[model samples]
Each structure stands twice: as structure tokens, then as C-alpha cells.
Target: MILHGYWRSGASYRVRIGLGLKGLAYQTAALDLRKGEQKAPAFLAINPQGMTPALQQGETVLTQSPAILEWLEETHPEPPLLPKDAQDRAQVRAMAALIGCDIHPLNNLRVLTALRQEFGADQATVDAWAGRWITPGFDALEVLVARHGAGWSFGDRPGLADCYLIPQLYSARRFNLALTPWPRLLAVEAAAQAHPAFQAAHPDRQPDADG
Candidate 1:
């Protein structure tokens, strides 16, 4: 399998973590988002959406981080990312969606760039825009995690929610959002960082990571 992604992309980070947890060894084809490499003709041929986190297995090219994660989970189910019970699985998926769908879309690179190019926003304004969406999403996430989480996001084990949450927290810090309000979520973040899989998949540890 070949994973094509940017170093700092949250969606890519989530897939990396999923691959690590599943103990899947795959080659990486780094597409430097800063250099617009994701939009290159070669990359677009693989993923017409021109998004990072596209997984290639033989002739099959998979796009969308969530879909990739689900495929990984289905193919490699030993270290399962979802819960056994149906209700618990739904809850876990919900928490993951809260971060992946609600929070992340608004703060993604394309959206930020649009804020700057289309609306004449500066860096500070862009950061503020990120915070505006992140803060409220985090507020709700904190409550949800506190309600359902044991050690990780859903239950005692690290699962799908953790995969999504950790990357969002990393992004939150990158945008200078105050994380103190979500102590429960922060604890989960700390636990995730300590885990070997997450440690291996960290942005700083990626081959294409820039200083």
C-alpha cells in the first residue's frame, strides 16, 4: 500500500494513526501541500478531489480520510478501532464525526486560504477564524468525552475517536487555541501521545515534516 499525504494534514495524520494501530506497513508518497503538490497532474489522476490522505493499494486508490480509516478497520480487525456493541460503536463514530466533520472542515488549508484570498483576511484573522469554530466544537467535545470516555475518548481503549481527536488537538495547538477548557479531552490527548502507535504517526516524525 502507498499512502499519499502532506506532513501537517490532520486527515492524513488520522490515517497514519489508523495504519499504525492496525500494524500495517505502507510506503508514503508525500505531497507537499505548501508547494501545491496535491494539485499536480499526477496526484489529481489518483484523486480528482486533489486532497491529501489518498491510499493506493495495487490498482485501487482510496480517497477521503474517514473512508480510508473504515477500509483499514474492516481489512485489519485485530486491533479493532470500533467498539463491539452497536450503541457503543455509534457513540464512538459520533465523537469522531464531531471533530472530523464539524471542526476540521472549517479550519482546513483550503478554507483558510480562501479566507485570505477571497476575503482579504490576514494571518491573525485566519487564526481567529480557526479559533471561532474550534472553541465551540471543543466545548461540545469536552462534554461528550467527559460523559462517555473512560481513559480514551469512548471507553477504556483507544479507538476511532482517539484517532480523530488527537489530530484535532494538534491542529488546535497549531492555531493557538486555549485547550485548558477541555481538560478531559486534553487528558485523552496526553494518553494518545503516550501510545506507541500515535507516537509513531506524529507529524514531527513524518519524513516530509519541516522544521
Candidate 2:
């Protein structure tokens, strides 16, 4: 398998973590978002949406991190990302969705680029715009994690929620969002930081990382 993604992309980070947790070996094909490589004809053909985190297998190319992660979970099965219990699975999915659907989208590269190019947002203004969405979403996540958390987001094991949460936290820090208000989420972050899967998936560790 080959993962086509940019180094700092939060959605791409999710897939990296999932692949690591599942012990799946995959090569990476970097699409430099900074240079607009994702929109190039070759990549646009792979994913018409021109997004990062497209997973390519023998003949199948999957776009969208959420769908790719779900596919990983379904196809791999062992070291499952979801809890076996149905209710617990839903709760984990809810936490993942909170970040994936609500928080992450607002801070996507496309959205931020549009804000800067079209809406006259300066870097400082863009950072504030990012924090506006991240802070409240983290507020809700802090409560949910504290309520359901053992050490990780959903339980003691790092599951689906951690896969999503870690990347969002990374983005939050990127935008300079103050994380002091969310102690519970920080605890989850701490747990994930020590896990091998998360360690391997860190943006700084990627082949094409700017740092």
C-alpha cells in the first residue's frame, strides 16, 4: 500500500496512526501541499477532491481519511480500533467525529488558504480563526474524554478516538491554541505520545516533514 499525503496534514496523520496500530506496512508518496502538488493532474486523477491521505492498494485508491480508517478497521480486524461492545463503539465514533467533522474541517489547508487569500485574514487572524473552532471543540472533547477515558480517549487502550484526537491536538498546537483549559485531553495526548503507533506517525517523523 502507498499513502499519498503531506507531512503536516492532520487527516493524513490519522491514517498514519491507524496503519501503525494495525501493523500495516505501507510506503508513502508525499504530495507537497505547500507547492500545490495535490492539485496537479496526476494526483487529481487519484482523488478528484484534491485532498491528502489517499490510500492506494493494488488497484483500489481510497480517499478521505475517515473512510480509509474505517476500511482499515474492517479489513484488518485484529488489534481493533473500536471496542467490541456496540455502545462503546458508538461513543468512540462520536469522539472521532467531533474532531474529524467539526474541528478539523474548519482548520483544513483549503479553508485556511481561502480565508487568507479571499477573506483578508492575516497570519495572526488566521491563527485566531483556527483557535475559535478548536477551543470549543476541545471543551466538548475534554468532557467526553474525562467521562469515558481510562487513560486514552475512550479507554485505557488507544483506539479510534486517539487516532483522530492526536492529530487535532497537533494542529491545535500548530495554530498556537492554548491547551491549558483541556487537562483531560492533554492526558489523552500524553498517553498517545508514549504509544509506538503514535510515535511512528508523528509529523516530525515523516519523510517529507519541513522540520
Candidate 3:
């Protein structure tokens, strides 16, 4: 398998964690998002959406982090990312969606660039724009995780929700969001970070990471 992605992309980060946790052996093709490498014809041929974290297995190509994650869980079920019970699985998916769908889309690189180039937003203004969405999303996540989580996001084992949460926390920190109020979420972050798989998949540990 070959995974194409950017170092700092949260969606890519999630897939990296999944691959690490699954102990999958795969080659990486890094796209320099800062240089508009994702828009290159070669990358667009793989993922017409021009997104990072496109996974290619033989002739089969998978786009979108969420779908890739589900494929990973289905193919490699030993260290399962989803819960056994249906209700619990739904809850886990909900938490993951809260971050993947609600929070991340607004703060991704493309949106931030649009804010600057099209909307006349300065760096500070862009930061504030990101915070405006992340804060409320995290506020709701804090409550949800506190109600359902154990040592990790959903339970004692690090699962799908943890994969989503840790990256979002990384983004939150990048935007200087206060996390002290979200103790449960912070605890989950600490737990996930302590795991070797999460550490291996961190942005700083990636081959293409900038400084």
C-alpha cells in the first residue's frame, strides 16, 4: 500500500495513526501542501478532490480519511477501532464525526487560505476564525467524552474517537485554544500521546515535517 499525504494534515494524521495501530507496512508519498503539490495532476489523478491522505492498494484507491479509516477497521480487525456493540459503535462514530466533520473542515489549510486570499483575513483574523469553530465544538466534545469516556475517549482502549480527538487537540493547541477547561479531553490526549502508535504518527515524527 502507498499512502499519499502532507505532514501537518489532520486527516493524514488520523490515517497514519490507524496504520500504526494496525501495524500495516506501507510506503508514504508526501505531498507538499504548502507548495500546492496536492493540486498537481499526478495527485489529482489519484484523488480528484485533491485532498491529502489518499491510500492506494494495488489498483484500489481510497480517498477521504473517514472512509479509509473504516476500510482499515474492516480489513484489520484484530486491534479493533470500533466498539463491539452497535450502540457503542454509533457513539464512537458520533464523537469522531464531531471532530472530523464539524470542526476540521472549517480550519483546514484550504479554508484558512481562502480566509486570507479571498476574505481579506489576516493571520490573527484567521486564527480567530478557527478558534470560533473549534472552541464550541470542543466544548460539546468535553461534555460528551466526560459522560462516556474512561481512560481513553470512549473506553479504556484507544479507539476511533481517540484517533480523531488527539489530532483535533493538536489543532486546538496550534490555534492557542485553552484546554484547561476540558480536563477529560486533555486526559484522553495524554493517554493517546503516551501510546507508541500515536507517537509514531505525530506530525513532528513525519518524514516531510517542516521544522
Candidate 4:
């Protein structure tokens, strides 16, 4: 399998963690999103959207991080990424979506670029743009986890939610998003970073990671 991704992409990071947790062996194909390499004709052929975290297995091509993660969980169920209970699965998916959909999309590279290109926002202003979205998304996440703080997001073991959460936390730190308000989130992130799978999947450890 070949996984095409960018070094700092949160969506790619989530997929990396999923692959690691499942103990799957795959090759990495770096797409320099900042350099617009994802839009190149070669990459476009593989993923029309030209998005990071595109997976190639044999003849099949997969895009979208969440869909790839679900495929991983289904194909390799030894270390299950989702819980068996339906309610628990919903909670995990909700937590993942809170980051993937609500926060991440706003702070993603393309959005930041558009802010600068279209709106003439400076670096500080663009970062503020990121904070504006992340703050509220994190606030809601903290509230949800406070009630369901079963050691992890859904339960004691790291699941789908935790996989998504760690990358969002990484992005928070990247943009200097104040995390003091979300103690539950900090705890969950701590648990995730402590795990070998997550540690190995960290952005810095990736072959394309920059110093």
C-alpha cells in the first residue's frame, strides 16, 4: 500500500496514527501541499481532489481520511479503532467529526492561503482566524469529554476519537491556540502521545517531516 500525504497535514496525521495502531505496513508518497504539488497532473490522476492522505492498495485508490480510517478499522480489527457498542461508536465518530469537520477545515492550509490571497490577511491575522474556529470547537469537545471521560474519549483504550484528537491538538500548538481551558482534552492528548503507536506516527517522525 502507498499512502500519499503531506508532513504537517492534520488529516494525514490522523491516517498515520490509524495505520500505526493497526500495525499496517505501507509506503509514503509525499505531496508538498504548500508547494502545490498536490495539484500536479500526476497526483490529480490518483486523487481528483488532490488531497493528502490518499491511499493506494493494489488497484484500489482511496481518499478522505475518515473513509480510509474506517477501511483500516474494518480490514484490520485486531486493535479495534471503534467500540462494539453503537452508542460508543457514535460518540467516537462525533468527537472525530468535531475536529475533522468543525475545526480542521477552517484551519487547513488551503483556507489559510485563501485568507491571505483573497482577504489580504497578514500572518498574525490568519492565525487569529484559525484560533477563532479552534477555540469554539475545542470548547464543545471539552464539554462532551467531561461527561464521557472514560479515561479515553469513548473509553479507556484509544479509539477513533483519540486518533483524530491528537492531530488537532498538534495543530492547536502549531497555531498557539490556548489549551488551558480544555483539561479533558489535554488528558486525552497525553494518553495518545504516550502510546507507542501515536508516538511513532507523529509528524516529526514521518519520512517527509521537516526539522
Candidate 5:
């Protein structure tokens, strides 16, 4: 398998964690987002959406992190990325969605770029825009984590929510948001820091990160 992604992309980071947790050995194909490599003709041929985190396996190419993660869970069921109970699975999916759906879309690179190009948003304004969405989403996640988290986001094991939450927390820090308000989420982050899968998947550890 080949994973095509940018080093700092949160969506790509989520997919990396999923691949690691599944113990999948895949080659990295780094797309330089800063250079608009994702929008280039070659990448658009792989994914017309012109997005990162597109997974290629033989003849099949997969786009979208959520779908990729779901495929990983479905194909590699050992060390399951979800709880056995249906209700527990739903709860974990909800945690993943809160970040993937509610928070990430607003603060994603495209939106931030649009804010700058279309609305004259400076760095300070961009930071403020990120914080506006991040703070509230984190507030809700803090409560949800307190209720459901054991050691990881939804349980004692690192699962679906951890894959989503860790990347979002990384993005939160990148945006210069103080994480003091979410101790539960912080504890999960601490748990992730010690976990090998997450350690391997960190954005800074990526092959292209230095460039």
C-alpha cells in the first residue's frame, strides 16, 4: 500500500495513526502541500478532490480519512479500533465525528487559505479564527472524554477516537491554543504519547516534515 499525504495535514495524521494501529506496513508518498503539490495534475488524477491521505492498494485507490479508517477497521479486525458493544462503538464514532466533522472542517488548510485570500485575514486573525472553533469543540470533548475515556479517548485501549483526537490536539497546539481546559483529553494525549502507534504516526516524525 502507498499512503499519499502531507506531513502536517491533520487528516493525513489521522490516517497514519489508523494504519499504525492496524500494524500495516505501507510506503509514504509525501505531497508537499506548501507547494500546492496536492492540486497538481498527477495528484488530481489519483483523487479529483485534490486532497491528501489518499491510500493506494494495487488497483484500488481510497480517498477520505474516515472511509480509510473504516476500511482499516473492517479489514484488520485484530486489536480492534472499536469496542465490542454496539453502543460503545457508536460513542467512539461520535467522538471521532466531533473532531472530524465539527472542528476540523472549519480550521482546515483550505478554509484558512480562503480566509486569507478572500477576506484579508492576517496571521492573528487566522489564529483567532482557529481558536473560535477549537475552544468550543474542545470544551465539549473535555466533557465527553471525562464521561467515556478510561486511558484512551473512549476506553482503556487506543481506538478510533484516539486516532481522531490526537491529531486534533496536535492541530490545537499548532494553532497556539492553551489545552489547560481539557485535562481528560490531555490524559488521553499523554496515553497516546507513550503508545508506539501514535508515536510512529506523529506529524513531526514524518519523512517529509523537515522540508
Candidate 6:
């Protein structure tokens, strides 16, 4: 497997965590998003969307972080990411979606760049834009964590939600989003960060992490 990704991409971070959790061995191809390499014709041939995290397992190419995560869970079920019960599975997936769908899309690199370049927004303005949308998302997440979290986001065992939530929280802190109010989230992140898999997958530990 060849995992093509950007070091700071939260979606790629999620995939890295999944791979690490499963103890999967794969090579990495770092695409320099800052250099507009993702948009180049060479990369476009692999992923027409010119997106990071295009996983190539033999000839089968996978795109979209959520889809790739689900596929990984299906293929490697030992250290399961999802819950056993049907309703619990839905709950875990819903929480993942809350971050992957609701929050992440708004703060993606393209969106930030568009806000800065096309909309005449500055760096402070872009950070403000991410903070504005994420606060409500984090508020709702805080409520859910306070209600459902048992050690981790879904339960004592790390579930699908934790995989998504931890990385998003990392991104939240990266963008200077206040997390003091979300104690449950902070606790969960602390615990997740302790795990070797999650620790190994952090942005700072990635091959492309800048000094």
C-alpha cells in the first residue's frame, strides 16, 4: 500500500491512525500541498480531485477519508474501530461524521486558501472563520461527550468517534480553538495521545513534519 498524504491534513492524520491501529505496513508518498503539487498533472492522474490521501492498495485506489476508514475497518477487524451492536455502530459513525462532515470540510486547506485569496481574507480572518464555525460544532460535541463518553468518546474502548475526534481536536488546537470548555474532549485527546498508534500518527511525527 502506498499512502499519499500531506503531513498536516487532518483526514490524512485519521488514515494514519487507522493504519497504525491495525499495524498495517505501507509506504508513504508525501505531497507538498503548500507547493501546489496536489494540483499537478502527475498527481491528478492518480486522483482527479487532486486530493491528498489517495491510498493505493495494489491496483485498487481509494479516496475520501471516511470511505477509506470504513474500508480499513472492514478489512482489518481485530482491533475493531466500530462497535458490535447495530445502534452503537450508528452512534460511533454519527460522531465521526460530526467531525469529518460538519467541521472538517469548513476548515480544509482549499477553503482557507479561498477565504484568503478569493475573498480577501487575511490569516487572522481565516483563523477567525475556522473558529467561528468550529465553536458551535465543538459546543455540540461537548454536549455529546458529556452525555455519551465513557473514558473515550463512545466508550472505554477507542471507537470510530475517537479516531476522528482526536485528530479534529488536534486541528482545533492548531487553529487556536479554545478547548478548556470541552473537558471531555480534552480528556479523550489526552488518553488517545497516550496510545502508541495515535502517538505515532501525530502530525509532528509524520515524515513531512517541518522542524
Off by over 4 Å in 3: none
lDDT of each: 0.92, 0.93, 0.91, 0.90, 0.92, 0.88
Evaluation by TM-score, superior candidate among 4 and 5:
5
Quick one: RMSD of model 3?
A: 0.9
- Give lDDT tens digits, candidate 4, residues 74-100: 889989999898997888899999999
Instruction: Candidate 4: give the clashing pairs.
Output: none
lDDT of 2: 0.93
Worst 10 residues of 4 by lDDT: 147-156
Predicted model with the maximum lDDT: 2
lDDT tens digits, residue span 73-132, model 6 = 998997898888998888889888989989999998889988888889987888888888
Model 6: residue 175 alpha-carbon error in angstroms: 1.5
Candidate 4 lDDT at 211 equals: 70
lDDT of 5 at 167: 94
Give the higher-lDDT candidate: 2 or 5: 2
Give the clashing pairs for model 3: none
Candidate 1 lDDT, tens digit per residue, 133-189?
889888998888889999998888989999999999999999988889899999998
Question: Candidate 5 has which clashing residue pairs, if any?
Answer: none
lDDT of 1 at 138: 87
Give candidates' CA RMSD values in order: 0.9, 0.9, 0.9, 1.0, 0.9, 1.1
Q: Tens-digit lDDT track for model 5 on 46-68?
A: 99999988999987899999999
Position 9, candidate 5: lDDT: 94
